[model samples]
Target: MISLHWLILSPLIIGTTAKLMPIKAAKKIMVLFQTALLAAVTMIFVEVRQNGPLLENIGSWPDTIGITLRADLLATAMVFLSCFLFLAMVIFVHNKNYADHLFFFLFLGLESLIIGIFLSNDVFNIFVLIEAATLIITILIMYKQASVSVYDGMMYFLINVVAMSFFLMGLGMLYKKIGVLDFYALEAALSQVNNPASLILPYAFMITAISLKAALMPLFSWLPKAHGTPSAPSVVSAILSGLYVKTGIYVFLRLQTTFAPLIDTSELFVILGFITAVVGFMLALAQTDIKLLLAYSTVSQIGVIMIGISLNNPAAYWGGLYHLMNHAIFKSTLFLTAGMIISEYKTRKISEIHGVYSHMPAVGVATILSILGIIGAPLFNGSISKFLIATGASGSWIESGLILINLGTIIVFMKYGQLLFGHSDKKEAANSDILEKAVVLTLSMLCFLGGIFGSDLIAILFNISLTINPLSYGEKMLLFVGSILLGLLIYRSLFKKRNPLAFIRSFELGFNEICLSITLFFAFMVVYLKITL
Candidate 1:
C-alpha cells in the first residue's frame, strides 16, 4: 500500500512516465498529474494546520533506520504556495505548444526534488535532492533549444552541481565526526565541542554552498541568464524562484537553529545579505529586458529575505517567510505577464514592447497590479511583509540600509510602470489565448487580494494575532508614498538619458563570467588570508 507521504512523489512518477509517451498525450497527462499533486498538497496543508507537524517514515522502518518525511509549518506553507503556482502554469501552458515531451520530464523531476527537499530528514539526502533539482532545472532551461538558454543552463548546472558537491563533502565530514547523517544528531554533536576550527569550517562550507544555490549575491550570476533565457512557464519560474531558492535558505535556517553553537555569528550572513540586497537592485536598475530585470529583482528580494532570517528574531523569521510567499506570487505573476506580453508583441526588450496596454488590457492590468504588490504599495500583500522586515530591523543600521533597498525597489518598479504606460500607438497583438489570460488574471487577483487581507492570513498561518490597526496602516502608507517619491526622483535624475539596452549589450557574456570567477577567487582568498594573517 502506498502511504500518504508518497503522494508527494505521485506526479513525478506519473509525469516522468507520461513524458515517454506521445507529446500530445504527455502534456495532457502531466496536467492531470499536476492537479493531483495540488490536491495532495492541499490535503497535507490541511493536515499540518490541524495537527502541528506531520511525519511518516518511509517503508514503515524505525526512525533511526528509515528515512523520515516530515512536514512542518514552513514546509507545508512553501509546498502549498508552489503547488498553487504549478497548477496555474499548467493552465497557462495548455494553449502554448511545445515540440517535445522532455519539458514534462524536467517539470516532474523538479517537482519531485522540491518535495524531497522539504520532506527528507537526512542532511545528505537534502544535498542529493538539491543536486537532482539543479540537474533537472538546467535541463528545463535548455529545453528551449535556443543557444542562449542552453549555454546559460550549462553554466548554471555546472555552478550549482559544484556547490552541491561541496555541500555533500561538508555533510560527509560532519557525518564522520558525529556518526550520524541526521541534522538533529549532528547539531547535538557540534554543540558538545568547543573547537572553533572544527565547527566554523564545516558550518561556513554548508552555508556558503546553500547560499550559492539560493542565488544570493556574489554567487547569483547564473540566475539572470537561466531565468531570463528559458521559455520558462510562469508556474515553473514561480516555484523555482519562490520555493526552490528558499530551500537553500531553509537548510541554513535549520543549521542556525540546530547547530547554533557550531555556527559562526550572524554577522557574516547579515553582511552578505546587505551586499546582496544593494548590489542586486543596482544591477537590476541597469537592465532593459523585462525578464532579466525581474530576475535581478528576485536576487535582490532574496537578499532582503536573507537579512530577515539572519536577524534570528521571531519577527524577522515570520516576516522573511511572509515575504518569500509574497514574492513568489507577485514576481511569478509579473513574469507571467512579461511572457504574455512578449508572446503577443514578439519581443523581450521593454523598449520594443510599448503600447502593450492598447492590445492586452487584462495582461497590462495584471502586470500593473503585480508591480504594485511587489513595490510594497499600500494595502498590497507585499507592504505588510516589507513593513515587518523593516520593523524587525528598526533601531539598527540595517534598517537604514533596508530603506535604501526599498527605495531602489520602488525606483525599478517606477521605471517598469512607465514602460507599461508610455508611448502608445495602438498595435495589434498576435495571440490572445483565453486560457493564458485566465491564468494570468487569476494570479494577479491573488496578488491584490492577498495584500488586502495579509494580516488575517498571517494569523491563520502562524497561529499568532499580530497587533495591526489603522495606525499601522497609516505608517505603512507613508513608507509607500515616501518610496514612490524617492523612486521618481531617482529615475528622473539618473535614468532619464541613459539607453538601457547599451548596458545589457555590454554585460551579455563577459560580465557574469567575470563576476562569478572573481567571487570564487575571493572565497578562496578569504580562506588563504585567514590562514596567513
Candidate 2:
C-alpha cells in the first residue's frame, strides 16, 4: 500500500532527479511525475471517501509518537485544486522560455509542500511543511529578474520569516505547555489550562504571522506588491492568488475549532473581516493597474471567507468552504486570462488596453464571464456560495455587513467589466496563441458550468440530498440583483476618478507598525478597566 507520505516525497525525488538530468529530459520527467502524483492524490481521495480520512503513521512508530499523514475532505479538495491548476499552468507556459528543469522542479516541489501542509496532523510537521512552502514561494517570486520581482520577493521573505518566527514561538509555547506537538494533545492541554489570557500571547503572535503571509488586512501591505511584482505565468498567478492564500484560512479554521474555549475572540475576527472587506475594495477602486486591482480584490474576497468562519454555524462552514473552492476556480481563471492579456499587450494598465476583444475574442469572452462570476451574477458559480453566506448571516447584525461587502464586490467587478468593454470597436492585429485561447476558454467554461451545477456538485461531495427550493432561490436572486444595482450606482457616482484611491492604501503601509505599538497599550487599558470595576 502506498502511504500518504509518498505524495509528499514523489515531487522531492523528481526535483532532485531533475538536478542530475539534462534540462529537456528533466522537464519531461517532472511533467510525467506530476501526472502520476495527481493520480495518487485522487486515489487517496477515493480511499478517504470509502473509508474515513486515511492517516499514515511514520516509521512504524506508535500513533502517539509518530507524525501522521492525513487526507480529509478538505485536504483532498485542495489537492484536486492544485492538480487542476498545475496542469493548466503546464499548458499555459509551454512556449515560454523558463528554465524548464528548474521551473518544473520548483512547481512540483511547491505542489508537494502544499499538499503536505494540508495533510499533516502533527503541529511540528505543519511547521516544517509551512517553512518549505514559504521557501518555494520565495524562489518562485524571485526566479525571473525584474526590479519589482526583487522588491516583492524581499517584502514577502521578510514578512513570512517574521510570521514563521511567531509560528515557531507559538508551537514551542504549546509544546511546553502540553509536552506534545500534536493537535489532539494541544487540545487536551488547552482544555485543562486556566486563564485564557495565557494563551492569547501565543495566539496573537501565530495569527498575526499567518495573517501577514495570507495577506489579511491590516497586514496586507506586501500583497499587491508581491502578487503584482512577479511577471507571473498565467497559471502561477492563479495558484498564488487563488489557492496559496487559502492555506491561512485553513489554519485559522483548524486552530480556532481546536482551541475554541481559549478564543474569546470570535467577534474580533468579524470586526477584522469587516475592515478587510472595506479596505480591500477601497484600495482596489484606487488602482489603475489591472493586476494590482485583482490583488486588492483578493484581500476583499478573503474577508468574505473569514466572515463565514467567524459565523460559527455549520451552514457558514459549508458556505465558506464552498466559496473558497469557487473563488479558487474563477479567480485563478481570471488571473491566468489576465496574464495572457499582459503577455499580448505588454501593459498592465486596464485603461490602456482597449479593444482586446477585437483580436482575442476568446479572451474577451472569458474575461466577461469571469467578471460576471466574481460579481455573483445569477447562475454563475459564485452566486450560490455568496447566497449561502448571506443566508448564514441572516437575522444577525453581521447580515448588514455581508450586504455591504456584497455590494463592494459588485462595484469592483463592475469597474473591471468596464475595462473589458472599453474600446470594443477598436481593432488589433489578429495574432492570438492557441495555448492562450485554450486556457482562457477552459477556465471560463468552468466558471459558467460550476455556477449552474454548484449545488449538485456540493451535495455529492457531502453525500447528502440537497434541495433547491423556491425560497432559497428567490432570496438569493433578490440579494444578487440588489447588490449589483447598488454596486453600479456606487461605481458611477462615487468612484469614477481617473486617479487611483490612496486612502486605505496609505493605511496598510504604516498601519501594522502603529498597530503593534498600540496593541499592548490597549490590552493594558482593558485589563485596567476590568480591575477597577
Candidate 3:
C-alpha cells in the first residue's frame, strides 16, 4: 500500500528537492534518489508478484467516486522496467556534464508521470499523467536549446496537446455514459450498457489520440525529429525509444481491453501494424543519419509488437510482451552506443563512420549484440520472441508479413552494420568512460541471456508455458541466414548506389497535415467498427 504511494510521489519529492539544492549537491541527491526509487520499485514488484496486485483508493473513497491506484502484473512489470531503464540511464550519463539540476528534475518528473500512467486505474488519471509526461519530455528534448530542436519540441508539444484534447473529450463522453472512470468499473458498466454503439464515438476519439501517441502509420512524422534530433541528449533518445513510446502501447492495450465489450478493433490494429512495420523499415533503410536510422527501427519494432499482441493468440501476446522488454534492452543500447559513436566520430552519417570494432571494442561489441537481437538472429532475445510470435501466426498472411518485415529489418541493420568494419581516413580518439561501457555491455549481455533462457524467462515473468522444438531450430537458422544474404544483396545492388528514395527522406508533413491524418484515422476506425458491427 505504501509502495504505491512511494512509486507515485517519491520521484516528485526528489525532483522538488533537487530544485532547492545547489547544482553539484543536487546531482548527488538525484543519483541517490533514483537509486533508492529503483530499490523501492523492485521490492514492490516482488510484493506484487507474491500478493497479486496492490490496490489503493485515494482518501479512502468508494470505487465509484475515488481515484484508484492498482499495481497488477502488467503495471508492476512496466514500473519495474521503467525504474531499471531510468537507473541505467542515470548511470550512463553520470560521468558527463549533462547532469544539470533542471535536467535531473525534469527527467525525474517524467519518470514519475510515466509510473503514474502505468499504475493509475482511473482513466482520467491516466490522461492527466500522459499530458504531464508530454510536457516534461518536450522540455527534455529541447534541453540543449538548439533552433531545430526547439521547433521539434514545439511540434511534439502541440501535436500531443491536440491528441490529449481528443482524449479529454472522450473521457468526458465516457464519464457521461458510465458515470465512472475506474477501469474495472467502467468495463463493468460498459458490459451492462444497452447501446454499446453509442460508445463508439468516444472510443474512436480516445483511440485516435492513442494511435498518434504510439506513432502509428501516417501519425509518426514527429517521432524521428524528436527522437533523432542531434541536439537532444542520448539518454533522452533512449528514454523515448525504450520507455515513453511503450506507455502509449500500454495504454492502447489497457483501453482496448477495457472497452472490449463495446468494440474489438484488434483486426484494425493488426493491419495498421503491418503497414507501420513496412513503412518504418522502408524509411529506416533510406536514412543516412545513424540516429534517425535507429529511431525508425524503433517504429518498426513497435509495429511488430503491436501485431503480436493484436493477433489474439496467447503465445503471440506473451511474445509481444517479451519483445517489448527485449526491445527496451537492445534499442536503448543501440541509441546510447550511437550517441557515443557520434561523439567520438563527430559525425551522424553511417557512411562516414567505420572501423568501430577497431576503434572502441566495447561499444562495437555492444552494437553487434544489439544488432543481432534487432534482426532476430539466433541465440538473441529477438529470435525467441519472433519465433513465438511466428508460431502463433501459423502460416497465415500475418506470418508472411512478419517475415517480410524481418527481411526489411535485416536490410536496414545491414546498412547500419557498415560502421563495424573497414577503415576510415578520419582519426579520432575513441574513449568512453567505464560507467557508459558497463551500462551498454550489461544491456547487451541481457539480450544474449534473454534468448538463451527465453522459455524459462517467459514462464517466470508472465507465467506462460511454451515449448521450443529443437527440430525446428535448423529451419529457423536457415531462414535467418537466407534473409541476411538477401538483405546484403539488395543493399549492395540498390542502396550501394545513391539512395533513389531520397524524396521520401526529404518529405515533411506540416501540423495541419498531421492533424488531418489523425482525423482520417479516427473516421476510418469509426466507419470500420460500424460496418463490422
C-alpha lDDT of residue 80 in model 1:
72
**Model 2, stretches more than 4 Å misplaced?**
19-28, 424-430, 464-466, 497-533
TM-score of each: 0.92, 0.91, 0.97
Clash total of candidate 1: 2
- CA shift at 350, candidate 2, in angstroms? 1.3
Residue lDDT tens for model 1, 46-93: 778888887787889876467777788777777777677777776677
Give candidate 1 misplaced runs (Cα > 4 Å).
1-4, 19-29, 230-236, 423-426, 499-533
TM-score of candidate 3 to 2 decimals: 0.97
Residue pairs that clash (backbone atoms under 3 angstroms), model 1: 380-451, 381-451
Global Cα lDDT for candidate 3? 0.89
Worst 10 residues of 2 by lDDT: 517-526
lDDT leader:
3
Candidate 2 residue lDDT tens string, 1-533: 56778877777787878888877676666567767777877787777767777777888787648887777877777777777777667666666677577777788788888878888888778778888887788778877867778767776776667667877887788677668766666777788887776666566656666666566666777777667764755566678888888888887777786678566556667777778888888788777778888989999988888887787766666777788888887888788778777777778877777676656788889888888787778888877777777777889977888778878878887777665655643455645668767877898888888778877877755544445566887877887788777777777877766444645445545335634633443354246334432
Clash count for each candidate, listed in order shown:
2, 3, 0
Per-model CA lDDT versus the true structure: 0.74, 0.74, 0.89
Better of 2 and 3 by TM-score: 3
lDDT of 3 by residue, 148-246 (tens): 899999989999998889889899998998889999998888888777789888998999999888988978888998899988999999999988999
Error of 1 at 117 (Å): 0.5
